[model samples]
Target: FKQAETSFNEALRIDPAFVAASAGKAELLEWQGEYSQGMSLLQPLLAAQTDDPAVLTVYARLLRRTGDAGKGMDVLQPLAESGRVSGAPLRQVRFTLGDLSDQLRRYDEAFCWYKLARQYRPNTFSAAAHRRFIDDLLLRFDSKSTQQLNRSGNNSTQPIFIVGMPRSGTSLTEQILAAHPDVFAAGERSHIGRIVQQIAPLRNPTRAVLARHAHAYLNGLGDSSRAAQRFTDKMPLNFLYLGWIAQLFPKARIVWCRRDPRDTGLSCFTTNFIDPALAFSDELEDIALYSNSCVELMAHWQNTLDLTIFELQYESLVREPESILRELLSVLEL
Candidate 1:
């Protein structure tokens, strides 16, 4: 990671507005236990795009961890409405908020938030394992959804969705991208789920319904009273909604993160996630089956979407992060 950070810094020297470089460095710093510096760098970007569900979600988390509960809530308020990333981040936030609420003894509100977060992702694994497990499960979801998938997004905001199988390094890739001056990560908004929710009556929602939902969700997210522009979403499971995403946010960029099957599967199976949707948990065979399905799903998306999708390999990024990031940024035209 340090090596990658150095590479990113070099890239930024050539282009300061390089969002991926900045995001990569910031996330590296954060993971290295340099929260103060990481938050310092990310805060400005967040303020610029508080309406971004992904940015708000992560910023709110960092703020709460740094002992600014009130401010964190303030950041999260808007994004919570219609933003749609689920799995772990949502669960973690709700759990934190619930704990905070419990400390204040506001049990009811805490309960509601906890239930909501837990509604999708259960908490059975430690932090490290949770990330890995989700990767496998999300791919399973992606494989199925990517087949008949079709959805749209809010026209008001530009969405750059970062998705793929869990533990495929989507977070790492997003961090690199978000480091860029222009890119902001909205974190994981359940935009896909929100679309699904809106078209609940339809056995299968049309691409138009998905588009309307995406648009409505984004339109509702901006600070409005403030000025904020484009942002990114790292909902790995969003792969399931790619068909709709392509149709709705025609201009929205899609970054599909890829990782070695063995690594991803091992990571997924070894990790205990907070969600039960990952049917492969606790079973290596299940994980292997899921991984194969994910690769197949990716192939399907590439064939069906007819959209410009960027692919980033996790091993490649980890191996030569800056070079990979530069290529990724180039794809985003950053």
Candidate 2:
């Protein structure tokens, strides 16, 4: 790490305006725990390259971590407003901004970031999933037909977030929903996760972030407000954030995607996700540990929250998608 920092610093000394070098140096500093100094370096780079997505993402992260939620949004709001952010950097910024907004209880802002992210590159595995997830949520928020589905006056924006380990067939279930005209497939939106991040610290997010985030998530769907009646975000790891989500959106449904442990471990090992939480990717035992953590967390979510999150095994989804879809629709009253 020290060696990398030295090298990045040397490069920056040689070309002070080098954005990559500056960003690299900032990263090393962050890794070294010198966050403020690292961020100081990033600020100049961001100023020098105002429209660079990478700068916006890293800077936003710095702001969020350092407890400056609004500033982080400020960094990306311009780019978001321009509608020009695209490619990999755009994804990075949007994801981080979404993440930060969740941490700060700005669900609306987080959804905007997530929606923008899905827009920039909806072809990637994660992106496509999230895009579909957001679309589903939007449909629920504006659907007048939901009167029949969630008849308890709790159906509007009510959702069943299917979360678990990746490669767990969350996508397959979403595909089934996509086949139905009334059910929209929001492949992997962060509605639940963002709610947890934003309001978890308050000890009671039920009255805080969940409703705000849901509203924002719905608003972020923009002009696609009339396609479906129910939205389903299927990011599996959302199990970790389920506790807070249930508290916030009591009407929100949950679906925990389960798979054979061995299969989940092997799949994670083979796939390369850049998220730091997946840091257990390089080792077998680490993967097992992380997997166990996920299971434990999901149990907590189920035990504590009043919400009903259905458990769907991946193998079942693969073998009997239609049946599972019918059962799922029955549960949602769709």
Candidate 3:
């Protein structure tokens, strides 16, 4: 992060009017939870570059994050409605408008903006391919195969995985766990997904191969992981790899975060995720299809795998955080 900050600063020093550098710095601030600071940094650029899509988008995001959704909407709506922006900027603008509308409880307006945003990006998700992938996962990680594979994996109980559909409180769950001194929050990781891709063609992975993969996963968590009693990987899509997780770390806690499908689908639709794997989120129908597959796969894991999964309901967590968190902590033996 410091390196990034220095680079952005250097870019600005070399060319003070560098819009991209300023915008990138603002984005970095927002990523670091310094929303107000980001807003302040971008404020000067707005007057001169009012129609600049990058500046406007980052500034609007900072506004939204700092609890100024109305201001954000006012700033971005004209550019969006005028249709002056195109390509990635336009898509980002539409998504930001949707976010502002959603924050203001303008559900219909938000949906319209979200739909407009999707029009700029072509949907590339295939339901049949997703179904086939799930089928292959179920076939490869059946109870018998999982049992055979589980015999040789690492027995480390330090790893905790939070998995579910996008926007299903996975982040919230991780945040709560991270509040505990013994738990290190790794945030959303792509290691598991990458590992899955690497081992996809192996019909029968050797015990050494599984061990090596598992070790690589832990090593990827970095040096801070050594200090904490437990570390969390809150990649929502890790739901697809529960069977592999069961085989590799049978003792690791798996918390499945769930929200109302309507809410989940709505949230997924509104947000512009950078991950191409979430291209399924571009359309409501695709979101539903992908969500159903996730539900089915999760149920299969629960019914077949010997592993115990702690189910955390988003609504319940919101309403009764104390009790829910207590139960969750007990389940994790924290």
lDDT of 3 by residue, 157-225 (tens): 898999999999998899889999999999989998888787667766677887899998899888999
lDDT of 1 at 147: 56
**Candidate 3 deviation (Cα RMSD):** 2.1
Best by lDDT: 3
Better of 1 and 2 by TM-score: 1
TM-score of 1: 0.53
* Model 3: number of backbone collisions: 0
Q: For residues 113-209, could you state the per-residue lDDT of candidate 1 as single tens digits?
A: 6556545533343444544644543553354554555545344335678877788988887777777777666787776656644564464567667
lDDT of 2 at 291: 74
**Per-residue error at 111 for model 2, in Å?**
38
Residue 224, candidate 3: C-alpha displacement in angstroms: 1.0
Query: How many angstroms is residue 211 displaced in model 3 relative to the true structure, after the best TM-score fit?
Result: 1.2
Worst 10 residues of 3 by lDDT: 144-153
| Candidate 2 residue lDDT tens string, 1-334 | 7789889878978988888887777767766678799888876655666666666667777787788878888777677667676676666766777777787898786766665654543232343444454344334322242222221222355466777778777777777767767766666775556655665455333333445666676666544444667777777777666544544456877777789999888666544356655655545666676677677666655554567778888788778877986787787778
Report lDDT (CA) for all predictions: 0.64, 0.65, 0.88
The clash count for each model shown is 36, 17, 0
